[model samples]
Target: MGIIKLTNIRVYAYHGCLVEEGKIGSDYRVDVSVTANLQPSATSDHLKDTVDYVLVNQIVKEEMAIRSKLLEQVCKRIIKRIFNEIDIAEEASVEVSKINPPIGGNVEMVTIAMTLHRSDYSDPTQL
Candidate 1:
């Protein structure tokens, strides 16, 4: 098994509970990692045999563009999409960070993370 990671995907999106946050928007950083059997692609030297990083990036960008009230929700959606879309991926995780958030204290960002396995979804059809 091997892991493919897409790190520090920068996006500007409107995702927050505050009314101003929805209107003004904020910068966000997203990271996604997936574990899959890489031996096939490694030996075949073909893109089709491996987890496509391009598709992963596109998923992140598309999901981030949608509005959400919390980072946790964003993380869930990201992980769900990864597992559902990438059939080769056995497991996946996502981290979403809200840069320069509106929280009352000094903080670089507030992040929420979630990990999911293909088996975690009771229904195979859902995966």
Candidate 2:
């Protein structure tokens, strides 16, 4: 088993409870960590045999484009997408952060994070 981590993925997206926040958008940083068996790729040295970081990043980007009201929901979507799309990932964790969020005070950012195991996910297609 091994862990693959992607950090500080900067994306400008409109995701917040405030209506104006969605219109103007804000900077977001996402971090993801995936755990899976790496023995196959470790020996084969083939991208096909392992989780692709590029694909992971693309998934995050795609999800970020969709507007959401809460960071927790964003984190949930990211984790679920990774587990569903990336067959090699046995477990996944994600952190979603909004930079300089408008909270009526000086705040650098607000972040929400979540982790899930593959078994915990129920495929939407199946439902």
Segments of candidate 1 deviating more than 4 angstroms: 124-127
Give lDDT tens digits, candidate 2, residues 1-127. 9999999999999998899998999999999999999999999999999999999999999999999998888887887788778899999999998999899899998889888888764763331
Query: How much is the lDDT of residue 113 in candidate 1?
Result: 88
Clashing pairs in 1: none
> What is candidate 1's local distance difference test score?
0.90
Query: TM-score for model 2?
Result: 0.93
Each model's C-alpha lDDT? 0.90, 0.89
lDDT of 1 by residue, 1-127 (tens): 9999999999999999999999999999999899999999999999999999999999999999999998888887777787777889899989999999999989999988888888777764563
Best by TM-score: 1
